[model samples]
Target: MILGYSVTDLVGFFAKGLDQVINVVIMFIFAIIFFGIMNDSGLFKPLVKRLILMTRGNVVIVCAMTALIGTIAQLDGAGAVTFLLSIPALLPLYKALNMNKYLLILLLALSAAIMNMVLGEVQWLV
Candidate 1:
């Protein structure tokens, strides 16, 4: 026999699903707004400027920095946390230098993977 779910049952199921993730959705919205406000207020501008001077507007420095930060951020062995730490810190620099965002992301991912392997290898060796 086919199961028939009434309107109330469907609505309840939908509400249950929404309730489970409503907090996350709200927090995500606030985070986006916060970052937007910071960007609009130019909070990252000075950081971008300093990075330009330190790296001398070098594309290779951006790549090198991305890899270093990615590896350091991955120390905790959490991809989400690593990306959260690396992306925001590097995105402004990449954009300021007119570099490709995809390249930043690709390099971050590769570095993080290498970091994970190195950590795992050390553990296995021990």
Candidate 2:
């Protein structure tokens, strides 16, 4: 009765989209678990630490490396997943180096957006 959709009608509509909904839910769960394992196993810490050492604590180098990491992270064309994966890995480094958290997020967002566009991630398939 509300918005021309009775309860049964709404149920039917939801049933129609159930598979797509389930797939997204599963994807999110898997992404979270995968990233969790990486974080738990200390997979990314060394990389970030090395990058910090290589950059010699220069803000510019750190930001550029962060962007590069974000760009590589987006290669799979999933922005949310990229952010979920990159942010945790880089967050500690940003804090340790005393860099601005805003800058870290900004660089990641910008690089991911630009790389996604360049990689035709948003292009419709024929």
Candidate 3:
């Protein structure tokens, strides 16, 4: 008001702020929709079964696979998307095998951290 800015200019500023975050918003929306569809269509069920078979009920292999899958999921560079992609897909295997849920969280976080660090370095180098 003191600077005599019009009301439309202030409203436009709000839109500009949204413009800065619109990509993130769209990413989250698409991630949710894509994962939700994949999940409901039973795609992850077979993948989980195959993972379980490959591990043969071995805790170490399961943990390693969790780390590997977490790293793959984190390639998208968004934690929510990573978790949405991994956690539900892995939870049944963890339950069936009686593994520690904390391990699930830890491995996912660590793998994601590593990927984020590596990608950051790559971006800086480029």
Candidate 4:
């Protein structure tokens, strides 16, 4: 009798955990669909392309601009969005300069961390 009760309790706990995972998966799917629609609509592409064009032929300026982008991304309330925008631009520069990919990634992470700390203060105000 005790064994049967224990098994039923475990099943109940597992079902609850599974339900939470399902909820999270559903939310993620919806977010991806929304982001995909925006991307397909060319809403963010033009701005990104313009920034790429403006930074051409200036390596230092491009690096600074990327850091600035990372900083601004913090303000927009999503670190992943900032990372997605910056990494693509950084990869080409890293390859051309023969820079260590890990180091570049580390610097990018550090910049994001600093920006997040600054932005956290803004959150307190809200």
Candidate 5:
């Protein structure tokens, strides 16, 4: 018994959480489908390819641009969304140039952190 409730009475105690879990699963499913469609449409590949060429294989410029892009992507108000939009678009260039993937992640994370603080959203809410 829990707080005077019988075991049978507590059977449905966790049922509410299942609905929330299912909703999150459905949201992720739709997000994946959307990303797959965008990938197949050739929309992101060309943009990333062009940026790589324009940077002329310079790591400094690429890192700076990655930070900038990551920051701008955060305008959507979600860091996870920013990463989802930025990483896949930038990973190919990082791999092609033999750059450290961790560095790429660090730059984007730092940029996003700085932006979140400056914009007065995440911290202010706390």
Candidate 6:
């Protein structure tokens, strides 16, 4: 009766949400693997190395650098790729500074949010 119909509708909605989540996860995994492969190919090492050298052991500067990278990555419409690439570089600086791990995490989240909001229009133009 009514109860059966409601249950069916709830189940259908749950299934659709699950499917969307699965698709998103699969897409993320593929993007990560592709970015990782590119990094491993030495395509990005020169750029990353130059950045590391430029930072010169400064934690605040390193954090800002990662934030900039994250923003650029978002502008390129690939947050995951930016995160995957920037994190390894940032971690050593974070450790060296004895900074709280959560600070970097929070900065990343804020940077992504700001990038998405500010860059959304710019992305559409390109």
Candidate that would win on TM-score: 1
Count of backbone clashes, every candidate in sequence: 0, 0, 0, 0, 0, 0
Candidate 6 lDDT, 87-112, residue by residue in tens:
65565456555777788777777788
Misplaced by over 4 Å in model 5 are: 1-48, 121-126
lDDT of 4 by residue, 34-123 (tens): 666776686666555565577664657766665676777656766666666666556555555555677556666777899777778877
lDDT of 3 by residue, 1-126 (tens): 679989999999999999998987887788778767877787777776887788887899888888999999999888877887787778767967788889999999999999999989998999
What TM-score goes with each of the models? 0.74, 0.65, 0.64, 0.51, 0.64, 0.60
Model 1 segments beyond 4 Å from truth?
1-31
Using lDDT as the yardstick, the better of models 2 and 4 is 2
Relative to the unseen true structure, what is the C-alpha lDDT of residue 109 in candidate 5, on a scale of 0 to 100?
94
lDDT, each prediction: 0.87, 0.83, 0.85, 0.67, 0.81, 0.70
Q: Candidate 5 has which clashing residue pairs, if any?
A: none
Worst 10 residues of 3 by lDDT: 42-51
TM-score winner, 1 or 5: 1
Candidate 2 local lDDT, residue 114: 95
Runs with alpha carbons beyond 4 Å of true place in candidate 2: 11-48, 121-126
Pairing residues by index, what is the TM-score of model 2?
0.65
lDDT of 4 at 91: 56
User: Which of the two candidates, 4 or 6, achieves a greater lDDT against the reference?
Assistant: 6
Q: Please report the candidate that would top lDDT against the real structure.
A: 1
Give the Å shift of residue 93 in candidate 2. Answer: 0.6
| Candidate 4 collision pairs | none
